[model samples]
Target: MNKLIAIMNRVLSLFCISLSSILVACVIWQVFSRYVLNSPSTSTDEIARFLFIWVGLMGAAYTLGQKRHLAIDLLAMKLENQPGKQAALKLIINLISAVFTTVIMVYGGGALMLKTLATGQISPALGIEMGIIYAAIPLSGCFMSIYLLKDLLDNLTDISSSGTSTL
Candidate 1:
């Protein structure tokens, strides 16, 4: 499990880095074309927007897996030495996050992508299928779900052993 999670973390990190690099390049080209060349590239703006979405979503998933995502731990801090309660709280939090990510980002985003594809929607500037750009939503949601599952299982194990939450 640890190995799988480590592999996932590496893949997500690479994915986000690649997308971010492309996004930066696109923005640079757009800026250079607009100011230096006196003409902006038509597709760079749309491409940058799409890449931004992918990079942001994947980066978030990577951060979540790294346990580096922002979290308010006031209640958790209060729990302190109560390993069982803290573990329970962590489990509940992971469960809630899993449900929300599945329902909103996965299901809803999938539906939106399918509907757009069905309508043959395309981006104006890039002439690319809009559904392709929207694919990031459900993909990131799935990644988040995986991380949440791992956290959930870890919390469960901690509860069984009366250990502090590691998530």
Candidate 2:
């Protein structure tokens, strides 16, 4: 499982880097075309925007997988000496994160993606189905949920092994 997660993280990192490069190149092209050529490229703006969205979402998932997402951690720090409390707090946090990511992002994003697909709407400049662009939402959500589940399992294992009394 850890190996799978590591591979996924690496893939996501590469994906984000590629998207970032694409976005930068597109923006540069757009600027050069508008200022130097005196004609703005119609497709570059839209393409860059879509790439930016994907990079942002994927980068967030990658960060979460790395366990680098922001957290107060004041309570956690305070509870450091209390193994059971620390484990319980970690479990609760992971549970909440998993539910939010799964319900709001994963399930909701999936429904939205399907509806957009059925509507057959296409981007004006790119001429691609809008649903394809929106797919980043659910894909990132799944990645985040996977990380949350792994964290939850680790916390549970810690609780079991600590042999400390329950909170």
Candidate 3:
């Protein structure tokens, strides 16, 4: 499992880096074309927007995977002395995250994607199918789900091994 997550982290890292590079290049080209050439490229702006969406979503998932996502840990801090409570709290948090991500992002976003695809909706500037762009939502959701599962399992293991009374 660790190996799989490590590999996923590496892949997502590279994918995000590559997408960021492309996004930067697109913005630069757009600026150059608009100002220097006095003829803005129509496609670059739309391409950059789509790329930004994917990058932002995937980057968020990657951040969560790294355990660097922001948290309001005041309660956690107050429970500093209680490892068992901390573990339980973390487990509950993971469970909640999993449910939300699965239902909203994965299931709902997937339906949206399919509906757009079925309707043959296409972007004006890029002439690409919008479903392809919408795919980022569910894909990122899957990434988040995997990371949450790993966290949930780890917390369960901690609670069990601690041999402390269950909350």
User: Measured by TM-score, how close is model 2 to the native structure?
Assistant: 0.94
Clashes of each: 0, 0, 0
- Each model's RMSD to truth, in Å? 2.5, 1.3, 1.0
lDDT of 1 at 71: 99
The model with the greatest TM-score is: 3
Global lDDT of each candidate: 0.90, 0.92, 0.94
Runs of candidate 2 exceeding 4 Å displacement = 165-167
After superposing candidate 1 on the true structure, give the runs of residues whose Cα lies further than 4 Å from its correct spot.
163-167
| Candidate 3 Cα errors over 4 Å, as ranges | 165-167
Decoy 3 TM-score against native: 0.97
The true-versus-predicted C-alpha distance at residue 131 of model 1, in Å, is 0.7
lDDT of 2 by residue, 1-167 (tens): 79879998999999999999999999999999999999999999999999999999999999999988788999989998898888988888899999999998899998898899999999999899999999999999999999888898898898888876366
